[model samples]
Target chain A: MTDTVHSDSAPPNGALPGTGDENVTGDEKMWTARVRRAAMRTLPPDKLLPDRQPSYVASWIYVFGVLTIAALVVIIASGVVLTWKGPSWWHVSKVGLFFNSIHLWSVELFFFFMVIHLWGKFFMAAWRGRRRATWVTGVVCFVVSIGAAFTGYISQQNFDSQWIATQAKDGLNSVGIGAFFNVLNFGQMLLWHVLLLPAVVIAFVGLHILLVRRRGVVHPFPARARPARHRITGAATVPDEALPSSEIETVLHKDPEPVR
Target chain B: MIDVVSASIVNLTHPGHYLHWGFIQLSLANSIVILAMLAVFVLALVLPFRSGRRSRR
Candidate 1:
């Protein structure tokens, strides 16, 4: 398929019309319309789910973010099945046992892919070009995911869960949140694992993605382009933003220790 | 259905070596998971993406 859209080439903060922090308007005073207008201006449909991305975005490192989301989908789907089956049902029934294992492995993959995505973004300085909120939301999602995983472990109706809860409660108590987030109580931990934490993670992940869409992917670092020693001595090459996809790929492939 | 926990019996035959330092501790299996993530991350950066050409209009 032909690439339908050109990238939001310039830094989205300045280039996109009416996309700046203040997009003033009048006569649409009704709260709902005002919000709708604001949303449309900030993120038009095309941008909210763009068909085209910059050439720099095609690297394998970018795939981890989608992998993390895919793993979360499996985790949520399997968790729903496991929850519907009830806690003790898995111990005896084959189908329930299979779903439980699926849920468990999906959580493992979620964290595994999430950490890799984080590492890639960190090395790329993903917060650049007015994208700090995007990066912060991703960090919050990671932290909330850890909390969800902890609650999941402590919610299990097994010896391991009991051991973890009994050991964890003391540390939580010292922090003074043990009363509210009581690890020792299976009902509370299960509620958090299955509901509250997941909701927060999903919401934050959604917001993080929206922010990324609003601001295009961070531009490649200027430092990555080196002087072509043979082409013209002492004349530094231009940044990747101006290059076509093929040339950009060549630059990326020839990167001398791209991750600093 | 096989017990997921019982799957560990395969590894139990070769008891895992573990490392501990300060408040951090990890079995060989856990260490391998971390090291594998790092390896994958490095490979992701170095490996060429086929879709690079597709970025062109």
Candidate 2:
């Protein structure tokens, strides 16, 4: 009975006809298709490119994250120019020197803003609302960025670079990583600075941002003031004397809940 | 003393080596870069968000 049913329903091209319930249960079953579907569900277009944010998001503290991203853009653009011109060109030509300066300053700005953002998030307890992954990814990005910056310093091809490389080797050697890292090798440091570490940092930052968007911003602390009570005469009043000291204390100490 | 103070000011304005200790050197150009970075960081920190209104709970 089964063989007869299969033979009768099979199409000439051997492709199954779409079920009417295709919308309810998608037809595609390949791994990539499944992943794509899951990704779309997890990060819908509207959520990925949100038109609005919670009112609590309108804070100056949130601006440093964006500023750090802006500095990263500058750093990458200047880095590309520096890489295209080669190290000697930057050391000799005025145009190269200017671009090099921009690269240096942009990195400085990136780290500075990143540190500020890190501190702000720490103080805000940004890991709240199951956002531990986001916080961890951010910290990993910071660590990777330090590697990128260190490699950049070693690649500078100047007295400063020379001194830093010589000083850093001892620390690396003490940790037994120097055998592989070889800070004295300019070529290796240059590749790590320009290509490998930046890629890792970018990947981590992308994950961190995705998690942030997924979790939404954590809410600000709730106001401590209590609502006024209505008296028998219909006058609103604070009956502070009547309230229990412990209850009042609990209300004052209550922390804000995570924003939906 | 006046000459030394004036020279320091000139060094700050001009891009040249201001401090040298053994092989390590700190130049006015490097100092300016550091200052610019600090300025950007501070601005991002203190700058008002959207129409200068503070966010309220």
lDDT of each: 0.77, 0.74
**lDDT score of residue B43 within candidate 1:** 94
Mind giving the per-residue lDDT tens digits that candidate 2 earns over A225-257?
444642221122346455455544344334232
> Evaluated with DockQ, which candidate comes out highest?
1
Candidate 1 lDDT over residue span A1-260, tens digit each? 22233343442232334433123232234465557667888889998877667656677766889899999999999888888888888756888777877888999999999999999899889997678999999999999999999998887798879999999999999999999988988888999999999999999989988888898677676444444532211234564345655555345434332221
Q: Candidate 2: which stretches are off by over 4 Å?
A: A1-26, A223-260, B1-48, B51-57
Q: What's model 1's lDDT at A81?
A: 84
Question: Model 1 segments beyond 4 Å from truth?
Answer: A1-29, A224-260, B1-9, B12-16, B21-24, B52-57
User: How well does candidate 1 score on lDDT at residue A98?
Assistant: 78
How much of the real interface does each model capture, measured as fnat?
0.50, 0.28
Candidate 2: give the clashing pairs.
Answer: none
* Residue pairs in collision within model 1: none
User: Chain A TM-score for each candidate, in the given order?
Assistant: 0.76, 0.77
- Top lDDT: which candidate number? 1
Measured with C-alpha atoms, the lDDT of residue A130 in candidate 1 is: 79
